[model samples]
Target chain A: MRQLIDLFVSFFKIGLFTFGGGYAMLPMLQREIVEKHKWATEDDVLDYYAIGQCTPGIIAVNTATFVGVKLAGALGGAVSTVAVVSPSLIIITIISTILRNFAEYAVVQHAFAGIRVAVAALVVVSVAKLFKKGVKDVLGYVIFAVSLLLVFFLDVSPIWVVLAAIAIGVGKALKAGKGGEQA
Target chain B: MIYLCLCWEFFKTGLFSIGGGLATLPFLSEMGSKFGWFTQEELANMLAVSESTPGPIGINMATYVGNTVGGVLGGVLATFALVLPSYLVILLVAKVMERFQNNRFVQSSMTTLRPASVGMVGAAILGVLQSVLVNMDAVRAMAWSQMLSWPNLVLFAILLALYAKFNKLHPVVILAIGAVVGIVCKL
Candidate 1:
């Protein structure tokens, strides 16, 4: 019971504080889940992040679920997922109810204008960090460039990009094995 | 009926929007037009609010749209539906994860996925840049001088420079500063 509450409280804080998006939640998750609670190690968090990217859901929520299940069980998973989303539900409910015509307000618009700029910067920072960690090889760089162009210019679906990348990885592995046998 | 439809749509969104919360934007836009729950302008507002608020943007969006379409009940239902997929998927993965944690195929696939995820994030950055910094309608109308939002561009550059220099400032502080500047300058 104490563990469940701890999971809920920790993830609730993560949900409440993280701003930009799922990626933006990483630092908070690292601090609380990894450093404070010691629920998961840094490597575990990174592994969850990788798995979360491939899975079909919000990355933060997926990570919470993974950690939760690891700590407790299915019930822990349910609690953490709910805890993570609770802040969004409550805040959005309040905003939607109180400010029905949210856009018509000038102050809100200006605030959002400023927030949007910051959000863009946040996204750029996340992209730079991911690029540094991800592009370790020539093939990785090529894949990054190709996928970026494909999504940005051609409006390709990200799922297809991920699928193609998986195929390339498998194909490369097969080719390497063949070369190893020949040598 | 409204509740049911909301659940179904959000469930589909949860099932398909891989990568992260922002990936759901296109689907939400489509839902906006299809359901008439919110206008395109309203969707933009929701995106803004979702960004500034705590929690995953996609879940916030689901709640917002659901509340708009149905009610508080709708909001609850939509949020549950959205997360249901992740709960199930993670549970299943947890079972197999121990066995396959170091499988060659899995490792290679994850390796490739790293770059692909970076690309997706890059695309998301472009989308945000377009929405935040550029006014497409102005560009479409050939109002060349009005295409870029100068104030926003300037603000973005400042923040980018600050981040580049400091590199460790918490994002929340930057957002708070942005809000203050926005309110004071009314930009």
Candidate 2:
């Protein structure tokens, strides 16, 4: 029971504090799950993050669930997931109810305009961080450049981009295996 | 019936929107047109609200759409439905991941996926920049005077400078500054 509550409280804090999106939650996740709780190691968190990126649904929620299950069990997973999302549910409910027509106001419009620019900047920072971590080799850079152009210019679906990357990975692995056997 | 439909729609969204929360934008835009749940402008507003609010943007959006469609209960159902797939899939992966943590196939795939996900994030940044900085439609419509979105550009420049100077400042602080600047400048 204490474990479940811990899971809930930890993830609840994560949900409440993290702005931007799943990627923005990484530093907070590391601090809480890795340093504070010792629920997972840094490598464990990074692995969860990698898996979370490949999976469907929100990466933050997925990471929460993965860590929750690691700490307790299925029930812990449910608790953590619920806890992490609870803040969003409560906050959005309040906004939707109280500020239904707030966006129409000129002040609100200007606020959003500024917020949008800030958000873009935040995303720019995230992209720079991700590039540093992900672009390790020539092949990685090629994949990054190609996928960026495809999605940005052609408006190709990201799902297809991910799928193509997986295929490329598997194909390279198979070729390497064959060459090793021959050697 | 409405609740069921909301669950089904969001479930599909959760099941398919890989990469991250922003990956769901295209799907949400489609939902806006298909379901008539909200107009395009409202969807844009929801995106802004989701960004400013805590928690994942995708989950916030699911709740927003649910509330719009069927009220509070609808919001609850949609959020649950959206997260359900993630819960199940992550559980299964957690079980299998320990066994395959060092598998060559898994490692290789992760190698490729890392860069791919980064690229997707790059696309997400570009999308945000286009929407926030450039009024492409207005420009295309030949409203040349309105093309630059000067206020947003100025705010973006100031914030970028601040970020460059104080590299470790928390994002919420920057966001708060942006909000204050917005209201003060009335931009």
Candidate 3:
């Protein structure tokens, strides 16, 4: 019970402060759980991040639950998951109640303008970081560029892009593709 | 019957929404069109609240849309349905994860997933831009030059510079800056 409480509080803090969503939360997760608390290791966090990415739902929430479960068990996972999400849930609930009427108010309207731009900036920063970290080789770079264009210019369905990429990846693998660029 | 529909839609969403919450947007847009269960405008409102407030944008949307359509029970049901598959799949994968996690096939699949996810995120961002960037009808009514708002351009530059300088800064910090700028500029 005490361990679960600790897990919950730590995750709650993660949920409250984390900006830029799941991927942005990775370093912080590393710091708190792996470095500070010793609740988990660096590899654990990375594994969680990878799994979180491939799986559905929000990466941060999924990650918190994964770590919590790994560290403690079912109770730990539940506590941590809820702890991390409660802030956003409560805040959104309140915002929803107010937003229906207050959204177009002059002040709100003005505030959102700056907010939107900043969010765009944050997105751009994240994209750049992810590109650097994930796209190391020529093939990866090519895929990234092609994917971006397909989405931006062609307006193709995302599912198709994912499927096509999978086919290419599998094709490369079958051909014994060797190199940093293979994947 | 309704719950089944929710389950199916959210299940498919979870399976294909490999990137993250925002990736679900295009799917939601299509679902809205197909089901006639919600409107695009409502979905936008859901997004605004979802992003501003809480958990995953995807989770919040599921709850919001679900609850909006079917009450509290619906929200809970939908939320669970959306996350259920991922949890199960992850739990199973976690078992053999260490052994095969970095295997070539795994890497290749992930590599494939990377671009796909990027495309989805990019598409969602574009969707947001279309809605938030300018008033569409006004742009159509007037010339392109008049539609070019100086505030957005300057704000974009400021953010770009700040981001470049503060490479290590958290994304939330920029979000905070955006909020402050939002209030000040009345944009």
The candidate maximizing DockQ is: 2
DockQ of predictions, in order shown:
0.53, 0.57, 0.40
Write candidate 1's Cα lDDT for A114-164 as tens digits.
Answer: 776776776577678768977799989889889888877777766677679
Alpha-carbon shift of residue B116 in model 1 (angstroms): 2.1
TM-score of 2: 0.81
Instruction: List the candidates' TM-scores in order.
Output: 0.77, 0.81, 0.75
Weakest 10 consecutive residues of candidate 3 chain B by summed lDDT: B40-49
Give the poorly placed runs of model 3, Cα more than 4 Å off.
A1-10, A24-39, A68-83, A152-155, A177-183, B1-8, B19-79, B138-142, B168-186
Candidate 2 yields a Cα-based lDDT of 0.81
Better of 2 and 3 by lDDT: 2
Candidate 3 structure quality by residue, lDDT tens digits, A26-101 = 7778888988889978887888887787665668777887887677766667677777766655555455556546
Residue pairs in steric clash, candidate 2? none
Model 3, residue A79: distance off in Å is 5.4
On residues B1-187, what C-alpha lDDT tens digit does candidate 2 reach at each position?
8899999888877876666677666556556666788865466557667877888888898898899888999999999999999999988888898655666776787788778778876765666677778888888999988997888898888888787678888766677787778788886
lDDT for A139 (candidate 3): 81
User: What's the residue-level lDDT of A81 in candidate 2?
Assistant: 95
Cα deviation at B31, candidate 3, in Å, is: 5.5
